[model samples]
Target: MIEILELTELPRAKAAGALVADILQTMRSRAAVGTNLLDIDEWTKAMIVEAGAESCYVDYAPSFGRGPFGHYICTSVNDAVLHGRPHDYTLADGDLLSLDLAVSLGGLVADSAISFVVGDARPAESLAMIDATERALSAGIAAAGPGARIGDISHAIGSVLGEAGYPINTEFGGHGVGSTMHQDPHVSNKGRPGRGYKLRPGLLLALEPWVMADTAELVTDTDGWTLKSATGCRTAHSEHTIAITEDGAEILTLPNHS
Candidate 1:
């Protein structure tokens, strides 16, 4: 389901993107030691309702998931990475927390995520992992623009993480996003350029670059969704929904308040 937004609907897409970005950033700022993961979900629900938006997660019951997610956002702790289901867990000092959010507004949708550590203590290893992911994300974005192939973007991201000595996982990566949350054209974190789909105007993609500290293998948690590092090492994820235009790839999910 590759969706290209009409020019008229682009403004709405931007609005939806802005709303999700603002919410994610706000939640990240408020997240700290002792903050409950469930509480964050509750807060996310309230914000979606107030904005007249719909949460893409609540009813998401894909084969990969246990069932209806029943949460407004994904709260991934130090070990949890993708599909992190919000549960009863308290954040601790220096705990690395990742918040992934997606929402639909005005018939359009946007998705994004951010990872950060709580409290004042910054573990060197955790910081390095987080930095690598962030750098990879930036590289991916740099490779995106008009007429750029998806592989080009993947190559850019993989280069950064590979150089940093982290293994890449292809099971889950970025994708095209529009009216619905996930769309076609899987953007693997590691790939060669000059391959795959050709980029064009009006296409939207969520380019995320995530990595585990030491291994590429992942094991699902008891919750049946949260992907954790097989070696139990820490992980980090960074994502942003971007729209391609005549100018270049425009990032739509940048929160105004971030």
Candidate 2:
């Protein structure tokens, strides 16, 4: 299921990526104390409809998830990390919120995620965890380019989180993304460089680096979708979709409004 966009198709990929990034950033801005997670999902749905784009989540029934993900965006709170299904929970001060979004436009799909603190209570641990994931994401992107191997990106990401004293989880990591959401060439957060699929132009990869504050173990919530830290420690996730090109890895998921 690995998809490589032709040079002519890259423009559509960029458009889809920009839409996803913009929506995620918009959701981040709207999320605050007292904000309902379900409300976030609604907002995302509205934006997708207005843009004439399709949500890669809704109707998404992967083997790992419950049924059709019926939600437009993933709203992960403090302890939650990935596949965070939007619920009726209300955000609170100091709550660490992570939003993961994917949208398909012009027949191409792009995915990205961001972690931040809601409200004014800046918890030091949460901020540190968020920073670590962000830094690792940047390192992973830097390691990606034509002629590079998938392990190079993984090693680059792992080096950052490992040095920051965070445990890495490989069960769910980055993967190839294109016309559909998740694709092949699974990219682990930590691995040996020079050991995986060799990169090339036109290849699109969603590089995400996520970490838990204390342990690598994850426990699924009762909702059968949200993945949380086993120890209930705070977690952070950062991701972006990049397209490998002749110039290097072009980050397509950057917010156009930023």
Candidate 3:
């Protein structure tokens, strides 16, 4: 289902987006070496409750995932890229951590993700992977606007990641968000420009570009949720929710402190 926010709903969308961004930033700051993954989930739950926001992930039962996510946030580590279920694991130095979150505030929803290195150890390959995703995300956002097509954004994102030498995976990419966490108008990471859905004002899209270091193939963890690289190499993911407006695409998930 595709949703176009009315002018009155934009404020609520902004609020939800800001809350999502703030919570992710807070989690990133609190995540450190030896921090348990469960602790991160707990922190996310507390913050969501404090904000009076509902988690889109908790109790989420999608076809691809096992029923009921049963978690407040997605904590993807190292080889893990998407749908990472929190487990009884402690983070260690040099671990690449990706956190994806979506929440509803005032009946509007926003989603975002960020990947960063934990602790003081930043491996070169991991840093490069993270950088490529971030750059690709930026390119995608730049390609979005009131009249731009979804393919334009995809092409822009794919160009960066492909140039950086990471294979693109289309099985899971970005999507629309509004009254619910996931909506219609699937936005792939790579596509031909001038094709696909045409953008319109008030449309909200979550554009995420993720890549594994050496392979486009993914393997599901025994938990039945976490998606990891087939080669078990490091990976990174970056995402942001944006709203198409008359002027251009307005990024709603930028860090509040930034």
Strongest candidate by lDDT = 3
For model 3, the local distance difference test gives 0.94
Candidate 1 all-Cα RMSD: 1.0
TM-score of each: 0.98, 0.98, 0.99
| Residues 118-231, model 2: lDDT tens digits | 999989999999999999999999999999999999999999999999999999999999888899989999999998899989999999999999999999999989999999
What does candidate 3's lDDT look like per residue over 21-61, in tens digits? 99999999999999999999999999999999999998899
Q: What is the lDDT of residue 15 in candidate 2?
A: 92
Where does the lowest 10-residue lDDT sum fall in candidate 1?
249-258
Tens-digit lDDT string for candidate 1 (1-258): 778878788899999999998899889988989999999999999999999999999999998889898899999898888889989999999999989999999988899999999999889999898898888988888888888999999999999999999999999999998888889989999999999998888999998889889899999999888999999888999999998888888889886842
Candidate 3 Cα misplacement greater than 4 A, ranges? none
Predictions in order: lDDT: 0.91, 0.93, 0.94
Off by over 4 Å in 1: none
Candidate 1 backbone clash number: 0
Model 2 error, position 86 (Å) = 0.7
Models sorted by TM-score, best on top: 3, 2, 1
Looking at model 2, which ten-residue stretch has the lowest summed lDDT?
A: 249-258
Per-residue lDDT of 258 in model 3? 48
Worst 10 residues of 3 by lDDT: 249-258
Candidate 1 clash pair list = none
